[model samples]
Target: MLDRSRTREGHSPAEALRDTVEFARRAEALGYHRFWVSEHHGVPGVAGSAPTVLAAAVAAATSRIRVGTGGVMLPNHRPLVVAEQFGVLESLFPGRIDMGLGRSVGFTGPVRRALGHDKDDADRFEGQLAELLGYFTGANEVPGLPAEGLRVPAFVLATGAGAGIAARHGLPLVIGAVRGEEPMLRAVRDYRAEFRPSPLAAEPYVVVSLSVAVAATAEEAWRLLVPEAWAMAHSRTRGVFPPLRPAAEVLALPMTARERSLFEQSLRGHLFGTPAEIAESLDALVARTGADEVLVTTSTHDRAALLDSYRLLADAAGGR
Candidate 1:
């Protein structure tokens, strides 16, 4: 399960962080394989700006569930700093820590500047990734900082050119399922075809991340997804990603025709339905994409509904 620590309507960012930790504990108890947090800089709706720090908190809170970044945007920080941070995490949690890296710069130009990342830094992802791996494997060394000699499992947050990067580095690819099926499957195929056996990963492994919402009825599940879909639409149209609002309020808001179109389109990629329905859809997705693992990432306005979605999803995935 992945949590961006979304600050929904009627909730503070602090509350979102606390809720995320609580959610992680519950997910662990419910038998989730891993619980991941995301990194979002200068996004008011998201409170997970420092995934490594938050991961430490999560690791301390839960015993069984593997804790890691959904990913840390590698372009935002120095490769040495990232390695050290994850090295510390791996030392503390031992075999339970993960380091999923991404090439994305901040969402906006100002945010990018604030993070001291240029547009060109994104292009340096492959190099950054190599440097990160070198720290753990003792292949490449920094003069001042010694290699940690810790082997932290690494995953690339795959998208566009990222699949090729992951394949080249021999790291597992983690792609979002929000992209349509054909494109996603094609990306997976390309990743596997191009994969090289490095010291980190000897074979290709793909993890598909799906935005999920399960309920007693499909209608209720769709309701739970509305807040996130609408927020995504608003971000596209207004250039500002605001905190998620109540679904009823979102429905009542007067939106431009284009915004309404975008809202509906955004809803298309999600897997929302009753447990049986979601399970069937997810199974088909896994079969089609040949995903080695499935990761669920969901955010909603209502805290109770959000937790319930995880419960239903866990039940649905148990048989898999």
Candidate 2:
């Protein structure tokens, strides 16, 4: 499961962090294979700005369930710094750390400027990713500390262009099912066909990350997904991803027709239903994408409802 520790309207950031750690422990107990955190710089809706730091807290909180970055945006920081950070993580957690890298820059121009990244930085992701990976083996050594033989397994947060990079490096690809089914499947197909085996991976591997929620009733599950959807829609229209409002409040909000259209479009990327319905959709999605594993990334305004959604999902996934 992946949690951005999204800031809810009434809850403080500290509470979000606490909820994240608690959620991680519960996920471990529920037999989840891995728990990951995301990085969203300068977004009011997201509290997980430093994924590695949050991941460390998660690792310390749980004995199982591999912890990782849903991704560290490569363009935001130097490869050497990332190497040292993940090196420290691997050193502490040993075999339980994951180095998931992404190509995105900050969401807006000001944020990108703050990170000292240019507009063209997005084009340099492949190079940055290579440098970061090389740091793990000291292949393209960057002096200072020797990170020559560290073993923090790396995964690429595959998107349109990132899929090629992941294939070229032979790292496992973690693609989101939210990107539309056909496009995601095509990306996977291209990734597998072009894959070149390396020491890191013997063959192509795919992990399909899904925005999913489950409950006893389909209506309740859909309600749980509304807060995040509204948050996303608000971000698109307002240019600021504010903290999530209550689902009821979100539903009652007066929006322009265009904003309403965008809201429904955002909701299309997510899956929410009764456990059986979710399981069936998940199975079909997995089969179509040929995903080696599925990563569940879910969030909601209500912590109790969020936890219940995960519990229901766990039961459906046969993790319980």
**Which one is best on lDDT?**
1
TM-score of each model, paired residue for residue: 0.97, 0.96
Q: Which model scores highest in TM-score?
A: 1
Candidate 2 lDDT over 87-134, as tens digits, reads: 888888888999889888889999989998877898888888888888
Clash pairs, candidate 1, are none
lDDT of 2: 0.87
Q: What's the TM for model 2? A: 0.96
Give the runs in model 1 whose Cα sits over 4 Å from its true position: 143-147
lDDT of each: 0.90, 0.87
lDDT of candidate 1 over 128-196, digit per residue (tens):
888888777666747314336777899999878999999998999999854677788888999999999
